[model samples]
Target: MYPKLPSLMDTRIPTFLKNFNLQAFEVVGYSAINAKYQADFCHVSVKDAVMKGGGRRVHGWALWEFESHIVGNFHSIWERPDGTFVDVTPPKVGTKVIFAPDASLKITDDGTHQTLYQNRTSDPGLPYIDPLGNAANHPQWMLENSNPSLIEYCKSLGWNNASMA
Candidate 1:
């Protein structure tokens, strides 16, 4: 049997996201847009969808996994006129994503987005940290060990720190 997935309202969610009123949406699969790499082009794909008169774009956080921890990745999806949300880009894992919508944030030319983390591993050696204060909430290891180009791209996006690599 599969393990239970946590809800957006789960108590384990970090304090920073509590006030945002995050919601969970099911991943609709690969988008119909003709992008070279669909998985790597969420922001653009959603934009294309809207430009083609498909649906309006909605910006928010999508749950992702990094180094065994659940991370809330800054992501975007297409919301139909009928009020249904669809994940235009494929998720890194699972069939659904926990999304925290923030309509004020818009997608820019640069590929920049925020990330939040929750350490669910049983290992007591690595305790969870809130507001991961070391610059855009990115842990030092992620910055130092990730790809340099990705890091530079994040900087261009105004993250003030490298994340989501």
Candidate 2:
């Protein structure tokens, strides 16, 4: 059985504040432009900081586990002091939504465009996320109706029908 979405909560965010912030490399949101309707957001989790090295000097930079969430069930973004926040989800609002924590979102003059916080690549700013995922809300797949690309790619290996290696 798959999961289902609950609601959307868009916090009110003013633009003037979002002037100076770095945009996340890849922001996500619900969209059917390419496929099925869905709500997706990007987030990250952090484990205990581990130092990598011997002796008094640690060489490796702080290690981080980078991952993407296609549908996080509930998406919550932290707001900057100026009310600007890095959009965890790209503004698409495909159809429905889950938790938006913020309030009603403020649309910009340019349709399909929203101001996202951003900093240069040199700046070290990463989101420490506690993501909420719901399997029911994700895309459904069936072995009998698997993606054609995968089937074709597998066939190239010379495997016969009904046999997978």
Candidate 3:
């Protein structure tokens, strides 16, 4: 084993948050008991983008436990230097989120940790929370300008629930 990794504070938690535009991730389904959410059905809320949910916390800040259940990737969706959340996933707009540590596991008795990689194609896939500058939307900033179709698209995707996209 490489060695038991330290707490979120001890690890590279801060740097990760600085990079995130909002929430750490977009959780798509329930993994422990069963997968209740489908690939297309899950919609995580983002923070501070002004869709519905919106707010900004200090960097490297620690959020609550429930904040984690929605997003699972811990290794990648870590924290920021100011102690706020740095969401790598497509953020919602303004939802306060925290890492759900229960979503992850240590997987060893010796103490070292191994991260389980996740993606849209994988089980418990990665949630696409990136709300801004989507080239597919044409010019990306269309989100800010509030294009008619973009508004409808954002509504259909449940922008209210997203944390920081």
The TM-score leader among the candidates is 1
| Model 1 bad stretches (over 4 Å) | 1-9, 14-16, 19-37, 65-70, 109-165
- What lDDT would each prediction earn against the true structure? 0.50, 0.24, 0.28
What global local distance difference test value does model 1 have?
Answer: 0.50
The RMSD of every model to the true structure, in order and in angstroms, is 8.4, 19.7, 16.5
Q: Is candidate 1 or candidate 3 better by TM-score?
A: 1
TM-scores of the models, in the given order?
A: 0.51, 0.19, 0.19
Per-residue CA lDDT of model 3 for 1-165, tens digit only, reads 111222445223433333333335322222211122122212221222222333432222222122222222322232334444444343232232344323322222122221222211011222322222111211111112233543454455555322222
Clash count, predicted structure 2: 17
lDDT of 3 at 139: 10
lDDT of 1 by residue, 18-132 (tens): 4344443443433444433256546655665665656688876664434444445556788877878777676555656666575645433223443323322212343333334
Candidate 3 wrong stretches, greater than 4 Å: 1-10, 21-36, 44-165
Which structure among the candidates has the greatest lDDT?
A: 1
| Positional deviation of residue 67's Cα in model 2 after best superposition, in angstroms | 29
Candidate 3 similarity to native, TM-score? 0.19
